[model samples]
Target: MNFHVTNHTLYVGKIETLGVASSSILQIGDTQCISLYSMFDTPPESVIVGPVAPLSPPEGAESAEGEDDRNGDAEPESSDV
Candidate 1:
């Protein structure tokens, strides 16, 4: 099983249906879609049994933003100035 989130689109492969819900209780189509955040809160006991490659950020650690000045060891400004 593999799960991936790219460009705000989540892809879940190799799913197994535990049980079917009552159609009278709630309206459901042929396929069911669950939010990733909801699944993130609590995962199933024993589902998803497979190895998948780890995903990396689309952009590497190459930010154009300037570095923070406070990170340096420069001394603080004097009150005399």
Candidate 2:
């Protein structure tokens, strides 16, 4: 197999998010040759369908109750000069 590419130009201003999933390719420039292969076998019985639970807080993170203090909800202490 033989391949050839010439005079390729690409311009981008902004990209918010870009995701490349399994067996996916994102090419931005010219290339001489490329090859890719992927295989997937999924059984219907092995898949689970259910409501997604809320994500748990990360380790060593402050609890929701403590977040209020940091968010400046409490009134500041008045000091008399």
Candidate 3:
């Protein structure tokens, strides 16, 4: 198959799909990548598959808002100068 190359990137070809989701094998440099093409810009709320691997968080969840939760909840107290 002849791949179209442009701007240091190669457009291999369009991949056919039965669902809304589609994918293609793009040759970006030396790597042959499997790129997923989705009609939705972002993912759905929750994706369920198999016995595990839920992509979304559970319901009624709070956003971290850029806060780090790695060490658990903590508060900064006023230090004596």
Candidate 4:
């Protein structure tokens, strides 16, 4: 396999999520050679699928429900005459 790319331009503003599943390949640029091999011992029935749970926020990080409280807890500034 051979690839000749010239004057290639790629602009990305935002990427929310990118997922690469098992036995997959993600190539962005030109490559001279690529070899991939995957071996699995588990049978087809061994695979388990369940609901995807939402990840909890990190410690001290505000939760989505508490976004409105961000500016509500500021103490009032006192004026000195």
Best by TM-score: 2
Clashing pairs for model 1 are none
Number of backbone-clashing residue pairs for each candidate, in the order shown: 0, 0, 0, 0
Off by over 4 Å in 2: 1-9, 45-81
Residue range 1-81, candidate 1, lDDT tens digits: 998845555566765666644332232334356433222334594455668544344565355343345577544574332
Clashes of 2: 0
TM-score of each: 0.18, 0.35, 0.15, 0.30
**Model 4, runs deviating above 4 Å:** 1-4, 16-29, 44-81
Please say which candidate is ahead in lDDT: 3 or 4: 4
lDDT of 2 by residue, 1-81 (tens): 887756656778876657977677777666777777787778895565778654567776664443355667765574322
C-alpha local distance difference test of each model: 0.47, 0.64, 0.54, 0.64
Task: Please give the TM-score that candidate 4 achieves against the real structure.
Answer: 0.30
Instruction: For model 2, name the residue pairs that clash.
Output: none
User: How many clashing pairs does model 4 include?
Assistant: 0
> Predictions ranked by lDDT, top down?
2, 4, 3, 1
Candidate 3 residue lDDT tens string, 13-60: 876556542554433356654557557455673544678653466565
Once fitted onto the true fold, the runs of candidate 1 whose alpha carbons sit more than 4 angstroms away are 1-7, 24-81
Our model 2 lands, by Cα RMSD against the true structure, at 14.1
